[model samples]
Target: MKVADNLAQIQENIRQSCSNVGRSETDINIIGVTKYVTINRAKEALGAGVKNLGENRMEGFLKKYDEIGNDATWHFIGSLQSRKVKEIIANVDYIHSLDRKSLAKEINKRADRPISCFVQVNVSGEESKHGLSKEEVPSFIEKMANYPNVKVVGLMTMAPFLDDEAILRGIFRELRQLRDQIQAENWDYAPCDYLSMGMSNDYQIAVEEGATHIRIGSELVGPYDE
Candidate 1:
């Protein structure tokens, strides 16, 4: 199926999800995860009205950014290495994996402007995930004040890939609550207004629980083809 068609379906699902929780679908930003597809397919996503595109790897992100330019809002949605920050910092509009002090320091040093970042949290306690543990998020965010160039716009997490809807909703809900707790503080550097949880497999659940940004990959742009 075409990207447009897939997008329309996803939009409808988002509408329903929002309606279920008395929230507005307009608040949800759909990030077309284009890391796996070709640049042309990424363009196809842009043609379909997906203005935000997400890439997990620096090389892939640089490639897509070269072709797409400012045509789309770019999101770096994977673990970022401190050394690679200088290479991609200027080009990316949002960094979704701001998990460590070293990476944050690099972004602060490399970026010419304050960067919008989501402090990645390993809410599910999965050893494989790259994020701060839930207990460590607050202090970590607090320390972020020193990194003047990085702004904590939200919190991000990847739930365990499972069929249990209850567990999925729990993880998403926790992230929302955590975001709210932080947002309430009204830190100039960490407003923490967005919840960057959810993905192709469980975005509807994420939406119902208060996800402002959902990263859809295979369901929206298809699986890895490179």
Candidate 2:
């Protein structure tokens, strides 16, 4: 039950998934979602060779960042409040929830350098999910050019947890098409080259559909009691 064992399996899954789609396994960056686990467990993920780590909350991110420092590439993989941007802007390498202009303004104002961001899209149309609708994304990304310190590196989405593989694949494919459309624009501020989709339940399908970054939580790092 060591993290390394779990990681190996995940890696293999990624490898197989990539092969299915003619993608190189090296293209996939597995982000160990450590928000649900302790810092010690996060470190175990690092020790297991998980170079990227994701945390959802500011407090959790800061706590792990305090101990782990630059040893791991930090990803803030949750909805970020504009008020909390200053606290995490400098420490985080990637933000996977850049959905609105207000949050974008805060990140641009606070970041010393251009921060990598993935525009979150609510592809599933679920009212509970936080992201811009597909129709809103193009205009939203076009405006990102004004925020000099925020770089739109990719798009992020969360598919509904369901047993249907077809539904999961469709959601991921739509996001991938959206990413391609944005990438083709060649916007200097929004290269939009990556796809930050998938989680513990649907990463395999996400990869097959061209996910460059996958966030794994309970699978990569087991959930811990709060």
Candidate 3:
């Protein structure tokens, strides 16, 4: 499908989902997840009117960012290691996989420049994932005080793929509630605004619940290779 046509379809779906829950489509931001897709595809997306683009790997993004233009917003939506945080800190607009204090400090050590960052919370207790559990976030949030450069925009998570829609909603709902609680109790350190969840498979449902930023893979720009 043409990039424009695909973008239109996703936008229509976003509007329908938002309307379903009495939310405006304007509130939701669609980030084109371009992991494996080439820089040409990113250009196509921009040509098609996609202003936001997401890449998981810093290595790949570095090579592609200059070509994609300085206007396109770039987000690091994959598992980021402490070793590579410095290089990505200055470039990517947002780092969505921030899961720990150690990583935060590492990102902060060089984060002299302020950036939009999210604390990755593992709402599902899945060992395979990279985020900290809800119980661990408080201390992490506390630790965030040391980082003057990292802005705690909100929380993010990678939902477990399940056959049950209820199961999926439950995970997203939990993330929303947790974010609410943090903001309510810890206004000093917690900043709750962006809920970075959902992807190609589940973004529609996510928007219906309360996802301000959805990292759309697959359906947005098609499959991403390593």
Off by over 4 Å in 3: 186-189, 224-226
| Per-model CA lDDT versus the true structure | 0.94, 0.94, 0.83
Worst 10 residues of 1 by lDDT: 217-226
Reference-based lDDT, residue 154, model 1? 95
TM-score of model 3 (CA atoms) = 0.95
Please give, for residues 139-188, the per-residue lDDT of candidate 2 as tens digits. 99999989999999999999999989999999999999998899889999
Candidate 1 lDDT tens digits, 48-100: 99999999999999999999999999999999999999999989999999999
Q: Residues 41-150, candidate 3: write the lDDT tens digits.
A: 78888889988899888778888887764779888888888889888777788888888777777887877786788889998889999899988886777777778777
Each prediction's TM-score against the native?
0.98, 0.98, 0.95
Native-vs-model 1 lDDT? 0.94
Candidate 1: residue 149 lDDT (0-100):
98
lDDT of 2: 0.94
